[model samples]
Target: MSNSDPVLLIETVRPDDGRTESFWVALVITGVLLLGGLGILLRQEQTSATDTRPQLDLLQRQFLMELTIAADEIRFITTMNSEVSTDTGFVNWPLEQLLQEQLLPVFPGQSAKAWQQLEPGCLLLPQPASRIHFGLVLQQAGSSIHYAPADVPLPDHCETLLSWQRMDIQS
Candidate 1:
């Protein structure tokens, strides 16, 4: 080479192939282990859910029975919640008792200053749920439930109950 002439160096690269088989074997083993673990996790979750179903069914039944008893024995209408008219005297046993303890913890959202007639409806027991300022009247017979008017002038064939509806408030 003459003075200042460029000199080049070249390298030949080779890929390693002997260990390729071991790498693929390790990958396959890891995939199988991961899949097995995933399957076990899913099965455990399904078993837990199955166990909870029976508990949920029992809770539902107990809740229903308590509601029925509550509806059968409830009082109605105080001076703060209702007027002292004959209609007020007639109202008792609201259907809302069915969902009192189940729904609102503070069932009676009223003041204790409200007046209550010493007299109760047919089933004379302390009101189970909270006091409703205004609620719809209802009647129950065995399993049959029905809406009642402000003044129920019918025979005592069915059990009286009370419930409430939200008043439409215009914004």
Candidate 2:
């Protein structure tokens, strides 16, 4: 054939030649492996996402427990005021130890501090005639004991208590 003229030689096609079939098989195997890896990754991510909610829930429960204990401690302090001196009273008791041992262990990284200046009773009462004040005080004390900015007055004490309950549910 001339250099410019195309050769038209007849060649027999054979199915027994291994190279072409092997290449196709390798490509299909590689594709399947990649898809399997992707599926595994997605499943692991889903599992991790599901795990986070329980952790948050455990945190909320621990916080609520801490608040309840602290409220009881406050009540104890108030009750014991006549017998124990203020400096040597229940307020001065090692609350941090109780928190660390009983509550912090549940939450892992939670930290707590009790202040002498703030009393659960103060936040509980607005005036002598406010009959609902005592219940509000108990609720608020339980709510604020675990959260920060304790001085911020709750608009509705009952609502604040409900909010904590909701947080517990969501978590």
Candidate 3:
């Protein structure tokens, strides 16, 4: 064989095994799965955020119940004491007096503000929960809990109490 002669070595071309197509399919599937996972995560976060309102509503109800039970207990005690004069003005016991007497339980981050007596039989107290503003209303018959907006002031009179939405309290 001559040194510079053109080599005639046979070259075989391998048939296509569809590796490139398989890689593309895998890539597309992985991308879709990643995007789906991201969408699911976002939806869950949104749901969790919205879930807070009901939880806050529950908290407000609990606080109102606590205040109502304490007030009722104090009223019962006051009524049992026959020697003490049953003054109409003294019927709605002040929150300070209740706390001072250890009749009312102090919750975390509670405001030092006193409970307001809207009228002779109506008493309202503000809730201290940070997320939502609420008021607990005590009347002669049954007590009601109310949700107050942060921008609007609390009801100064029983007439204004109608403007607030009454929350459902179970028992």
Candidate 4:
């Protein structure tokens, strides 16, 4: 009976099919893809931000020119009106539509809007949703014409092209 006693042991065995290596490779690939996507997203954001500057410059130039034209026209009209006693019908028309026609081709996806329904003196700049409404400011500063952003606290001796009445009150 003692001789009949026997010991038995069981051991677990794993097959070497390179599964661990495969898992590591897959993890590395996923990480690289994620990083590449993140980098691309960041670059796109940078490019878009840079692109806005050129459009902004063009808008500013056009806005300033229009302001100069308006001021000269108004000053001339004022002189003419002083000489006459009756109201001239020329001063009542809104100027936004005419300006927009010339500027539409230069800047896409933006429409010129009046600063106020009753007044045709100013305009609010069109910008993307993430951006604020920057008012185009133009003024005659001595011999030189001054142009600046209306939202700026002190706009370097420039008068706003558009009135603040039409901008969102919360902004």
Top candidate (lDDT): 3
Clashes of each: 12, 1, 0, 3
Which residue pairs show backbone clashes in model 4?
Answer: 122-161, 122-162, 123-162
lDDT of candidate 4 over 1-171, digit per residue (tens): 487788678898899999999999999999999999999888873444343232346555565455455545543553555422244222332445435434312134555442322233233343453243444322121112232333433222223433232221111
The TM-score of candidate 3 is 0.43
Task: Give a tens-digit lDDT track for model 1, residues 1-171.
Answer: 887998888988778766888899999999999999999888873444343222223533443344344333322223234422355344343324423433211123433223222233222112223212222222222221122233433223223333222221211
Ranking by TM-score: 3, 2, 4, 1
All models: lDDT? 0.35, 0.39, 0.59, 0.42
Ordered list by lDDT, greatest first: 3, 4, 2, 1
> What is the C-alpha lDDT profile of model 3 across 30-99, one tens digit per residue?
9999999999888873444343234355655676577667656655675665323245433465555655
Q: Any runs in candidate 3 off by more than 4 Å, and if so which?
A: 1-61, 78-90, 104-107, 112-114, 127-131, 168-171
Q: TM-score each candidate.
A: 0.22, 0.31, 0.43, 0.27
lDDT, model 4, position 42:
84
The runs of at least 3 residues in candidate 1 whose Cα sits more than 4 Å from the true structure, single-residue gaps closed, are: 1-18, 45-127, 130-171
Q: List residue ranges in candidate 4 displaced over 4 A.
A: 1-56, 83-113, 116-171
Hey, what RMSD does candidate 2 come out at?
Answer: 13.9
Better of 2 and 3 by lDDT: 3
